[model samples]
Target: MTLTKSLLLGTSGALLAVAGAQAADLPSRKAAPVEYVRVCDAYGAGFYWIPGTDTCLKIGGRVRIDTWYTPAKSAVQLRSTGGPAYTGVPGGGTASSTYTSANGIDQLGWYARGLLMMDARTQSGWGTVQTVVTLRLAAQTGLAQAGQLSSVPLAVAGTTGATIEAAYIRFAGFTAGQAASNFTFLPSNQYHSIWSPSFPSGIRQFAYTATFGGGISATVALENMGDLAAATTANSLGFNPYSATAATATAVAPQRLPALVGNVRIDQPWGAAMVSAVVLQNNANFATPGIQAVTNGLGPLVRKTGWAVSAGLRINLPMLATGDSIQAWVSYGVGALNYTAIPNLNANTATTANYTGGFLRGDRDMTIYCVGVGCASYGVEQAAALNIAGVFTHYWTPSLRSNLVGSYIRLTPGSTTRNTDWTNGGLSSATGWSVQTNLIWSPVRNFDIGIELSYARLQQSLTGLNGAAPTAVPCTAAAPMCNASISPSNWTGRMRVERTF
Candidate 1:
């Protein structure tokens, strides 16, 4: 019995030892260390340090919805002409002669947009280096593309569009890539008002800003003018009698030089002020000077240069109320009408050359005319323009504010190069003005709702002053031809809601 007990004890001890040895040979279970994201306060709010790097990054975006209404007169004209159509009576007759009931007069429109932006910054030996990229997706309803003749659906329901608003880089006082120019100051009054001055929207360019102590800086840049002169000439003279001459004279000319832009700016406790200027080249080449028998032998035209200047001032009126301010600016251009904020003068669109005022009675930087047999010389008229805008803002409460804005623009074409009937009668001057007011409420951080009302008026030069002929339709006592000098005025109202982060 003693021998058996000893053997049993030895067997149990052997079993326990074998189990411990197996457990010791098994792999250990331990988790890897975590590298959590860290907040970065070095570069303002909303920035976080990238994992395992010193670079700071921020992501933000805005979503906006807008609804608006415009007068039937304006809407019909826009539908027929494809954009902001000239309001004066046509040479043949009144609105009845030019537009039909199918134009959908007095329409309401809505637009929704989503904007996304990413910013990355790092401190370098030279200075703080930064890169910014912004993208936009939009959907629209009830707004027709410029030049849609039929009542085709103008609304886009879903995210049917995308565009790059800005993509730029900055390092050591130098900015390169597509971005706003230094020439613009207080670019807009209310949200998306067309009456504001030409603010030189984002363009591909390189610029340098030099800081002078005391909140003063100067910038110089080279910007693409994008054949501005040729475009303006085409818009003024691309119809009927002048189409042939305009086509031959304003052929797409190669861009020889970029526009030179410069600005001086100062910021202070009171407000800010800036003076800006630009020089652009007006280059063109005639395609076939005397191709048609009627053109005679004129083939090539001379190249010209254009310039513009602007001055702006902003004054903080906190004494009146918190967030209160006033801003004013004026611009003058010679051969650069677009810089003066004239409608339909942008060079980016094919129909940009079309005028918002009526035909043969509006001004352009240049004009071309050919008439009668053996017309050798094409008219090349230099033009000048002026634009001014002012905005005043008042804060009723910490979360509520209102703005009043007004703008005026005038374009004067130079005297006819040729004393012919076509030159005299075909080209004239124009004046336009607009006023807008809006109230905006901010219910919470990064969110806003607003309402705006606006009015616009345009006046064209009278017919027959430049040897132009009167309308074919005779004047009636109720609406004399003389009254045709005024285009129909437009009134618009808008409501908007926006959220940002």
Candidate 2:
């Protein structure tokens, strides 16, 4: 028994040693060190630390769909786009005068937009350095927005486009690149900007902001406001007055200075307030005969400057709801009507979506008229504008809310007749008002659905005829513009669905 047991134990030990050595010879595999993306709460939600870097980065986007309805024969619609801006007839400016169903106008408009945003931030000795880039792709059919001409006929089937909505860098006390103009206070609670009197132009600028503790700050910026879709023009920077069918085309002086913008602002837990001012050079050369002043020895006309002032206030009403507030703003401009959110004749751009703005057909920075074609006797007059816009937001519940937005704008065309271009009649002052209301539902944090109703109207002060007249002021049956005293307006409704992450 002893001999058998001893042999068995020795054999077992020998086999185990051999197996252990073989196992050790095989390759070893340790679990890979997982590189999990670390969350960066320092910059708010959706931000994470880029691998092996101190910078925090966030990438997100939104998808939005919009559908709107405008009644037929709405005066708010531009006539050229198949909407009745001028009261010549119903279904005016259609592709076929009486060819398409005889006399019917399109009533439905739709738009879809996809957007992408990227933000990166890092801490440095000077301060936090940040950069943001945003891009958008959009398509539209029909129309309901403001200042837009690409309606049923112009955009017939549909139109597609892409744009770099914003790209900017900020560090220490400086901001650079394309961003919202410093002179404006866009209402945060408003949905349809058509009812708001906020300058919608995105401007190329270099700005410096100085902080004086306690959430108070001052900013000054140099912006190229004149660099519109078109570079320069005779009137509102590059914008023209729609009423100036016959006004002489004053030669535009090349830009000598960029627009100057300055603002003082205070932000606190309860609310925010700001006061802003801007100055721009009027580059129009005023002489009697078209561009004759620049060519026919009239010498260069003295360039006048335009200016605007704005003030805005916001008050939080947390006592009513978690996110409720009221915001109001007012602006006054002399020969700088763009500040009042009025549409310019210049082609609209992403920065300044003037196409969606309220219309003021006659007011202009410098109205130029010649005694006759090629005549050297010309004159100039400065127009003025005043606007007030406001919004009220109330949160009925955590997931339900509503917004009311309204705006009023007044224009003074000055004491001159701009009948040199279209030979309409004496251009008089006008006023416009817009009101909109919306209700939104947010079932989820990053998703929203809303419906809005809007109405806008324009009134003319045919003062030259001593009253308001829908018919012609100086009516001449042979003239195309003989009936020029009509006011335009429209009512529209929209539904929006949006998701962001």
Candidate 3:
């Protein structure tokens, strides 16, 4: 029995040894390792590292819907444009930068927009190389996106538009492609109000930004002004050049040279301060009558350089609430009012065409009296303008916030005595002011519902023979009060729902 047991044990041990050796020689089938996505904390949130690469990418989008209502400022309904004398005037006459009391124009409107954005960054020898692209798809109805200076509502109703709102590359402090103009000093977040300029998609340009130690920096850019807004629009010349009115700008040459823009800025814990300047070439259209020429004189269509300067300050008010702040901006322009946020520029006709033209009743860069060069004392004199704006913001809670904003505009139509006379057919001096308040509730991150209220007044003078607002629509030959002036001082309200990812 002992012998048999020993034999069995020895055999079992031999068999186990052989099996172990065979298993060791066989190929192994282990689970493959996972390539987990890594979070990139170097940049802000919502960034992740691409597998097998050092680059970081972020993808996001925004959708917004807005409904708005605005009333005409003047209670008196004026005569229509087809009248015997008021031929070139806006029919029923337009009013504020947002809307006018024009016939067949909508006092209420709505729009929806979607934006898709992608940002990619990679560490580089110069710092971080980044590229960003944003696409905007939008639809408007019932006179949405109207910012005419005149009372005539634009024809953008029932329009759908698409554009690359942003497409830029940054490397070694150099920026290329379409981006925000460096000439702006005030922050853009306060745009959801009647006082501020319309939300801008940025200008097409090449720029460079230099950072000094301690949040100080400077930037310079060259922008394609001709294509910036509808600057090329016929007869529409704004003092902010592109913000110009159509009535005065019959002949405007394309902007051959890109606008030169520069700014100096400082940012600190308390707040920020900045100063910006721009230079643009204003070329006269050869086809324009003498009144639209750079010089009504016999000289060939000449070129005049227009310029603008702006300053802004922002102060943090942490004592009141988290994210509370106050900001102020002032801009002065000589033929470059487009640099100033005054007429609520309408770069895209499909979107909003508010800045100037007959649409803008009170503001103008060139005061054109008639078609001939022998029009007035100064057929084409550069206009000067000033724009002032201030904004205040407070957070009632983590989810609730409000903003108060106001703006004032003044335009000096240089030497338009004969040019702006009712008989001569032109616009004269103008002034405007507006106040806006917005309350927003953000129950969660990336989503918000807000409402904005606005009260504004725009006063323009056609200078009755005595120099003041006229009394009649077309200053009839007998009464000769000058085409009537409508100072639309009215209220506007807007509600919006927006989601961002």
Candidate 4:
């Protein structure tokens, strides 16, 4: 008993000594436990360790629908369907390909869009990387109705497909894959004007963006030029069947749609402003491939290159509230029409024999400018054209808008003469103007109703060509006669409703 008690006391003394030593080492008070969580790259920045796995995801997209209507007296055919110069035509037949105006019946119509979007991302020490995807659904192919002529299909009635709109991988300061063309600048739009030429002007290309100090940024890319010329060439060579068939055979070139573009902006207390430029190759002739053989199958087939530059500004106007703003934009293009295809000079004629449409030459340019003011607008657009040529947009309310565009085109008329009539057929007065206006009301967030109207006029000075009534003014040289069928003017009208989700 004496030995056990002595040992126990010794052990107790050692424990007491150790406890006192630890208490001295500990902080003055009890400390709280720190928690740690994991984050993935997809979430974008600021990530902590997750319990398991190593990834992140993000999802976003907008669903929109458009509808419209117009007076029956208008020249535009609401139910018309066709492509390019041969637009307005309702049916697609080899014979109707040459008609400037459509031959379909007038009817009210509607189209809608359903879009789904998602993005997956991952993080690294350097930066974040993300893959984006978008799917579009519609009752009918909007491209066909919108006059978009791309080989790629964009819409389906009940299916899912990758959007030609924008599908790419982005990381650091670079973007690659099918992306928007780097030439457009006007961002505010409230009208559904027929003059909306660049509605979906983006192109699939590889691009890069770099941000400098301040609010300045730059972008560049390479595109496929829609391969219009190449397609024409292949069609002429029988490799493709999409080229315009004509009398003169021109070898369309494989236009390199490479575009170099950039923008610089300065953000001041007053507002933000930016300037941009883009250079891309376009087909010179819209008729057929570049013509080479005329009398003998020989000589050189030439193709042309085109480009455009633009400037835009958005002013918050300190005098106005944050919701109120003003915007301005302008774009100009030189040698923009690379419609290198030879015209089918003999299409409208009786015989099936093909003939050259014409050769485009000299400076071909286009210009667009607009000013807008609005807030609380349904579409969040700035300006709206009121149905005038060269006016990009005019919107008085959230659901009403309009636009009209005018153009002048000069080409090398075959045989120093014209071919078509009042429709601006031959080179005579290729100058044409079209007015498009739409009155729309979005009763709900994803639904809309609207009406559209348009009028177009073309003028030409005949040089020479076949005419039953020959006069001192050249004849039978390739120019069109002053016939009602060839007169240079047309009109269109449409009514429709749409829904989106």
Best by lDDT: 3
lDDT of 1 at 417: 27
Q: lDDT tens string, model 1, 49-157?
A: 9987879999999998887765343111211111123333332112333322214332566678899999999998999999989888777665323221112222334
How many clashes in each structure?
Answer: 10, 16, 24, 72
The positional error of residue 13 in candidate 1, measured at the CA in angstroms, is 16
Model 2, 409-490: lDDT tens digits are 7777655432211113234566667888999999999899999888777765433222333332232333223222246566
Worst 10 residues of 1 by lDDT: 74-83
Q: What are the TM-scores, per candidate, against the unseen true structure?
A: 0.77, 0.77, 0.78, 0.54
Best TM-score goes to which candidate?
Answer: 3
Model 4 residue runs over 4 Å out of place are 1-55, 61-63, 70-103, 141-163, 188-201, 227-253, 266-271, 282-301, 317-322, 337-425, 429-501
Candidate 4, residues 1-501, lDDT tens digits: the string is: 999999999999999999999999987976775645545544655433443435455445555544333211112210111122322221112222221111122222234555666666667776878677666555533222332211111222332233445577888867776554455444413323222123242445677777777777777766555522222331111111122232222234335456455666666666667676656543322122222233344223334445555566666633433334555555554433222111111110000000001211111221101112211011100111111113334445545444333322222322212322212222232333344455666777646666655554434343232432212222222322211122234344545555543
lDDT of the candidates, in the order given? 0.59, 0.60, 0.61, 0.37
Q: How far is candidate 4 from the true structure (C-alpha RMSD, Å)?
A: 14.4
Model 3 over residues 118-191: C-alpha lDDT tens digits?
Answer: 99999987899999999999898864766434434433538888988888999999999877778765555542
Clash count (model 3, backbone only): 24
